[model samples]
Target: MKNRFRLNLFRFVLLLFVCVSCSQEYDKALEDALNLAGENRPELEKVLRHYHGDTLKLEAAKFLIRNMPGHYSFADTTEVKPYYDEVDSVLTTMKGCNVWTIRDSLVKIDNKYADLSPEWVEDIQIIKADFLIQNIDSAFVQWKKGAWARHLDFEQFCEYLLPYKAEELQPLDAWRTYLREFHPDHLDELRYCDQLKNSSLQSAITLNDNLWYYMRPEITEASQVRPIYRLSTRLRMPFGICADFTNMAISVFRSQGIPVALDFTPQWAFRSLGHTWNVVLVNNGKNVPFSGATSNPGQPHKPDERMAKVFRITYAVNPDLKRLSEIEAFVPSAFRYPFFKDVTEEYMDCEDVEIEVGDSLDGRYVYLTVFDNTEWKPVDFALIKGSKVVFRKVGMNSVYLPVCYEAGGQMKAIGHPFLHTYDKEVRPFIPDTSRRVTLRLLRKYPVLRHVQGVVMRLDSGEFHASNDARFREYEMLYRVTDCSVTGREVVLPDTLGAFRYWRYYQPKNGSYCNIADIRFYERATGKQCVGKIIGTDGCWEGNPGHTKDKAFDGDLLTFFDAPVSSGAWTGMDFGKPVDIGRFVFTGRGDGNSIDIGDWYELLYWKEGGWHSAGKRKAETVYLLYEDMPRGALYWLRDLSKGKEERIFSYEDGKQVWW
Candidate 1:
């Protein structure tokens, strides 16, 4: 027995040593008896409230609650409840945009501050407890919510997904109800619109062929009649040749006192980025991409200078409709235009274009639209009772634009609000049943191949993020062939600026070469504008100037001398720094043309300060450059100051003579 006792004692000593050795690792534990013994510190109980479900955190919370000490109790001498009530009263005294009211219903079970004469000391304890309770409950409620909505970050970003949902009476769930509840005009459904309407999920497809489908008859009839006030407008960039030429021709014809509705084929080409043109409906018809309604044989209209560039064709939908793309020589398998990220200016929900009033909504989005050319007539809208015009928005949800209506031609729907209403139950659009069926089928069978996984590709396997279906819900013709996920995978050199490439040109032989990873692209601009330098050096063999200095023959890197502008601004100001830093010469020679000889002149206007920062004359500067020819390539170092002002050009005469 004595020997066994001695052995037990030895085992106890061994266990004690092992525990002492392990105490350092245990000290790092969040909160527990072991942690407290190791660190000799109080616990942060509130921190563990966020981790309520986890056993580790629960243990930490217990440690904190036990260790943290409280202040004096107030039950004997003074009433803590009355003070709490008084604080709640103060909260009700104020109200406004920047003001908030505090709730008056917290129960102080312990009269901790009753006898405390100085109210401030008692108030601190009460406030701290209140803060703790509020934070605990708030986290609990948020965590209970489902995974998608519970995520605060996603909730904050959700608005960007359904940007156009504020005023629209119906959201995704209420779309059918809204359509049935409200009156119906017509939804924009060309080839894919029908498919989209019946689809369980909201989505769309870009239909280039739809541009020529239903607008030919009307064009023939309208051409024979004398046209209205001939309207001239610019067809913006990224627009396809088919859309531009066909839509413009039809618009001119349709505006000749004939029936028409306006729609545009949306384009998001790698070459252009975001371009769209005319799509319309004529004579109470549905959405048309092209050729609709017949008035009579119209004279062949001249193409807009912009439309003159599209490849002409001879694919006519009707017997008499002879116009651009009527010959069908060129077939577009997939068209090129701008993408969503390419649009420079973003639009919003509100507009008062007809009244010359300019009020805008906070909701901003990039939309591609085609408007029918017609007189903006004033409608007798008895429904518009309120002084303020109310507008709503929808994407995948159905919305309608009107066609021909009411006696004696006095129509007014020039880009008016398009709305959708569903039955309290279900109402069918009989004429569009085929489209409806297709739309219903679409939701079940999503374009599986188009369910593209957005990835960050590198030398190794990629990490992918699902494309936000809600953000891009509209039926769009997306170019998925060259879709890339390689922006952040591999570290690329500065040569290509912002592109991904694998093969490049050999320095000596000018032959093509390859690397496992590279960054290179042919063009950078949204419009495929190949860069070009305007001015040239006296040597003329190569580029002789930088965008920075006056005396550079493509040798020195400095700064621009001054900001140059078209001299068009408010107050008739010339050389005002509104246009600052690097000068990018733009126009026909703006996209693809770039030259190395083009240089800039730097100047020092400040009289007193003498520093190296001041612009120096006759200093030759050369900067690293990679850009196309005939286009502009400039980066303004400073946008708002004159200290970095400079002129960009190649001719040496300006530096020597000026």
Candidate 2:
């Protein structure tokens, strides 16, 4: 009995010591924040005193205050508010207008505010006590009452639910209350859904389905405009870019007590521009990604899409990032902010890459970069240790370059470009100049599966001619057997009879008679034939520009996309029966293919940048580059025209797209 009593007493003393230590740490952090608050210290103290009676609320208040020094908002909203107001007005009044017209209007508005500069004010200095109290109370109410939020612990709640704003520079307001009350009717069915009651993912999917009906994503020139900082203004707008939709979704989900976050890739491994989306935290501690108003959770990305690294935006400052900023004088823009956490391993398999840097160039850090069409963009960074640098959790099956940033943000290559193969092998592109090989390139960019599908649709299409306007009686003048990237020409037989009407009838297997330019020639004259455009009453998506006449409009970039997938055809009416000798047709495509008359430049990766192999004018469907460096990453650029090109490697006499 005596031993038991002593053991209990010792346990109690230890527990009390731990609790007191934790409290002192919290108080120290709060003191630091108050010292930095300057004139706003009293407002923060008011919040602390108001929540003193409730232990949980007091802890929550401390969490917000401790991290408030780094959080800031735009100091001046005069120029920005009017911009969002005008955008909201335009989106409201021009609802259902042509997408292009609305985009043009938004672009003009964006330009008007392009010169506006941003000035920032820290949240700790300007935030009010009443606003913080209300925000805390509302957050606690939702966390305790919301069924989908039961799985989240106190840390998750603080990170995802308690934050007042989704991003920096956002206008602070009563967004939680407004969003919670705005669409009470939309989620009524979800409340009654027994299977979805406790499932955060399902609830998020159901809410997204309802929200998508009213909101949409539009990639417009206005996307380049200064961000709309007001959540209410964003809600009022009909459409927005990926980041806009993501921030809006985060507001909505958190308002309903669902733990959500924003995830993004700084740059795609295989293409230009980055992408952002929303993710819901579930019971298993896994995040499921879904595009707001676009796709459901677990939907696979497009086949061509690849991610070299993914990061999750967080409300708290990352300690590692803060350390990096302190040690390095200049950090790349991608890592300049301390509000992101790397979550690449959660999305795909990753590998740790260690490269030897013979010369560090007097730099302390090196970055792993991926090609972004026009240039190599840094996706992840590492510290230079001794003669080597180690990049952790890198995505596989992509090409990467190691570079060091010099003064004024200039990147200097420190290591050779290498491919991290899917089988977990690293192969450097050393450029074996001792041997040379010839390359026959088909296109600047790889023909993706979808593009190939469009090309294959031209097969089996039949050309018919008849006197009847309805083509009730017709003769099959010619049949298309194959099509190429440039196009195909079919020579009609000499015995073919003339007809007043001629049309290229689409095959049932074809995808909506998707044809670009088509031309017909008169027999024995070698002269192009012209007539009234006929067939296909409506175009896809009701776009007037894609009407049937576009097939004969002599523009390869535009095509006649039929509203229906079958029985759609476009052709010319001769107005009189005239013998047709041949016809030329091109398929709808991305126009990255080598054109017969276009000029192209072939380059290879060497040392730190691209070195020109040669330039040639394509005389055929493909370009031929002779005596090129073997075992090197190649890029074929269409100097004549194009904006889409990718880096590729030649293996076994074929171009392997990275």
Candidate 3:
């Protein structure tokens, strides 16, 4: 027994010595890699410390170094040595300053090197190192101790750090700066975000805040569109549309080591436009969806309209989709995006489907589409094999149409639309060939994508006993810009409103409509209502100096605002009420076209009770209203939420809403 014990002790000591030697070797390798970062070596060491004693991270770091583009072999010091020297020089000058100033300096260097020999430029690894160094220093101010202290594998690092650069609207490194900007002095509220430590489901609550979601008006001409950047957006902070919110939250959470992705539909299946949002991939391998500019983080963002397909953005290139560029010219621009990863399966409740196409299509690519509000939008595509093509894992509970790209880029339907049931059954929209199924789908939801301003005239300086034209009681006009090529012509109900001069208004960003002209004519006599102009009056705040007079000053440049209340009114009194039958609004040609009225309600006061004379949907540049009770007390009120009534009237006749 004594001899056996001695042998066992010797074996144990040998094993311990071997383990210690291996650990020392690992530590030396880590140190050498840190040194390669040059002036940013200390920050690299700090980051790697999170992975101390973990072989996985050590292996990942080695892999990252080996796989980094333009990494030189040991013998090629001529290429690698100068690169590191340049990086060290740049970072040495950048130490001790805030991220913004350092970034500005780096931009100048990058521009200067743009013309320099490509050989002098550093490897992407060096650029990544510099970014990390600068971001880590800035993160310290926000986190105060451990900002990105969490240990993440190489994949996590790529997901969080790799693709972040200056985007079209956001300046480079703007996200790191945001950490300090969000809660500079009092970040404790954001620091103890233990709630964010949970799965993406719980972490989303941290991202959900009071941010408004508004789509900027679509400009028909592409040149007029402006890209909104993250720095400018952050300067305003948390008060942006969906894109702004997504960028901010993405930058903040990714810096803290959370896996995040931005996904969006090219266009809503039910609406006339598209939307983008953020989603968090939790540690549990499940995706928790959320939007940056919304109040709902506990649940997936479900638009009132149906989504055709959801495309996920990823930093890594997908080999399966790399060949897609050959089939469609737009594929590379869409699928080969550095940030695009098709995770359609995660959001779409889909199933495999085999569609019959009569003969062999061979090399042709088949596409599937669903009818959007305006036209059919192609959602997914598959390559044809035999006589038929198969779409794998597509969304169910939707009507899908098979289409093919013709000689031109135009899509031609190949098969009839069939409803793919949730239970995986595909049935023709009209299963019985003899029985005609008349399915008329009318647009019930009005597009509110571009309702930017309200047009209404306030009550004429009156505190009436009837409370008819009191504060917050007048009909306010809601303005909306039409996205279609042709402007909408709304046939207003006989009693459209009490306002005589109708004016068009747009948001401060200057997104206006193209209105042609305005004409007020009597339907009975077919005569124009333009005659002796009636004087106009409206409710004004503070002083009555800029009253309803500005609305009818024959200057589209000037506008009169009503008190910021729901029931404010504007009125016009013609010398007397003639046969003032109907009014026609004209579109403006000066590009001042801001004719957007989403909803208009004409209320007439009769026998001390407010009566709805007529209400019409206004989505076009020109609006026409017919049928009127001569000399009646009528007023146009805004039904849109949280809008004050402002009116503009034009008439030789009399009696605006009184």
Candidate 4:
């Protein structure tokens, strides 16, 4: 009896210790939040007291209050509301119109309101008790009643479904209720189909496919204005960029009890800009990635797409990033917020990269940067330990540079740029001055194999001339047997007679008459001949700018696209017989090829940054750079015009793209 009494006393003491520790922790956190609330402290206190009767709800309220210090919304709604209103008005008026036609008006609207700046207010200072309560109750209903969300624990529920706003600058409104009923029939098919009712992935796929019918992805000048504040405004617009689409998906999915999060790469490993997409958490704890309104779940990215690092956005602060702040280290704007977690291993095979700085420790933080078009941008950060810094779980097969930020945030290179090769080897581009090689560059960017197949459609195409507009009786002018990136000019036979009507007929298996420019030359004066544009009546999607006249518009970037897949033709009519000396035609292309008479500059990467080899004017289809440095990363810039360029390494007389 004495021993039993002693055991009971010990259990009581342990329970008392745990309760006291939890209370102290909660009290400290609440004090810090209330101190930051200032004049809004009473609103927070009201939320806490309202949930005092329910232990679980009280903990939930505390969770939100503790994390509220860094959350914010737009303070000056009056200044920014007009921009959203104007954009929505324009989009509503132009409904069902082609995206190209709506682009100009959107650009004008964005430029008109470019000077408006909205102030930010912290959630701790501006959030109201009623608003917080509504969000919490709505989130709890979905979590308790949602069939697809049964696998989520309390922590996962708080991070993925409980957040009031998906992104910063969002207005504090009742978005959950509005979005829950936004698409009444989006999941009707899923409910009727027995195979899909039990699977969350299939339900997500069905919903995304249905959303694609109403909304599509479009990149325009106005894409810079993202994270549209009003949910109704975003729903009214039919087109949006990747980030806008992802935000919309988050709002819709989370409201219906599907756990979703946004994952992104700061910059693509092989391309110019970054990409954002939605990831739905499944019962197996795996994230299924899909473009919100453009692609379905389980659909893979294009083969050319590459990622060097992927991050998942979270509402909870990252402990690792918070530690960086504790040490007073400089953090880049890409990682300034503590709401992201590195998730590279979930997407691809990755390994830890330990870069040796060789005694040059400029600061406590070292960064890994990727070349983004015109400059090198930091994508990942690590701390210096002695002379080396180790970055964990870095994706492979990309070029990276190690650098440290000095005072004023100027980046200073600490080592030469190196390639994280696919074979898991670090090959640094240390220029060997003793060795040199001549580079014969054909294009600024690598031609994708699929796009090259589109260029090959011109083969076997026939050019004919006839007095009959129907071309029933015609004489063959020329038959193209091969195609080139820079196009070709073929001299017509002198014996060939002139005709009133001339046209190029697409082959049966060819793409929809995808020709960029076509010109006829006079035999007598050798001058270019002009005629009235005539051909297909409608373009792809009835776009005005993609009609038959685009072939004669003198813009290589513009091309004629036919509504029909085959037998569509674009040519000119002289109204009378006229002799043609030569024919020149260019196939539809991305305009990244070397053009005659355009200036270009070749650059190589050294210890510091890109150094120009020399500028030269292209006299032929390709540029020739003599005595260039061997074993280094190279970049070709079009000095005349163009925006798409990529880095490459010359090997075996050909450019190997990253």
lDDT of each: 0.22, 0.83, 0.47, 0.81
> Residue 323, candidate 1: how far off, in angstroms?
36
Candidate 3: residue 559 Cα off by (Å): 11
Task: Report RMSD for candidate 4.
Answer: 6.0
RMSD (CA, Å), each prediction:
35.1, 5.4, 15.9, 6.0
Across 200-239, the per-residue lDDT of candidate 1 in tens digits comes to 1111111222223322211111122111111121111111
Q: How close is candidate 3 to the true structure, as a TM-score?
A: 0.48
State how far residue 228 of model 3 sits from its true place (Å). 9.0
Per-candidate TM-scores read 0.17, 0.83, 0.48, 0.81
lDDT of 4 by residue, 417-457 (tens): 88887788888988777899999887787666656877876
What are the runs in model 2 whose C-alpha is more than 4 Å off?
1-30, 191-194, 219-225, 301-304, 359-363, 449-453, 461-513, 517-555, 560-586
Please name the candidate that would achieve the greatest lDDT relative to the true structure. Answer: 2
Worst 10 residues of 1 by lDDT: 437-446
- Clash pairs, model 2 backbone: none
Write one digit per residue (lDDT tens) for candidate 2, span 1-658.
9999999999999999999998898789789999999999999999999988999999899999998878889877775778888998898899888766776888899898888777899999999999999999988988888777888888889988999888888777888888886554446566677877778888788778766766655644236555777877776555567888888889888888878999999999987888899899986788888977677777765535778999999888787788778877678889988888999998889999989886544348788999988899999988877787889999999999998886578888887889998888888998999999999887778776667767866777778889999988999877777665555567888888788898988876546888887888888787888999999799889989888999887666788888888788988888899988887777788777666567889989898789998888965456778888899998888887878899999989888887
How many steric overlaps are in each model, in order? 105, 0, 43, 0
The residue-by-residue lDDT of candidate 3 on 315-334, one tens digit each, is: 44343564565465444123
Cand. 1 Cα-lDDT: 0.22
Candidate 1 stretches greater than 4 Å from native: 1-243, 251-284, 291-389, 396-484, 489-658
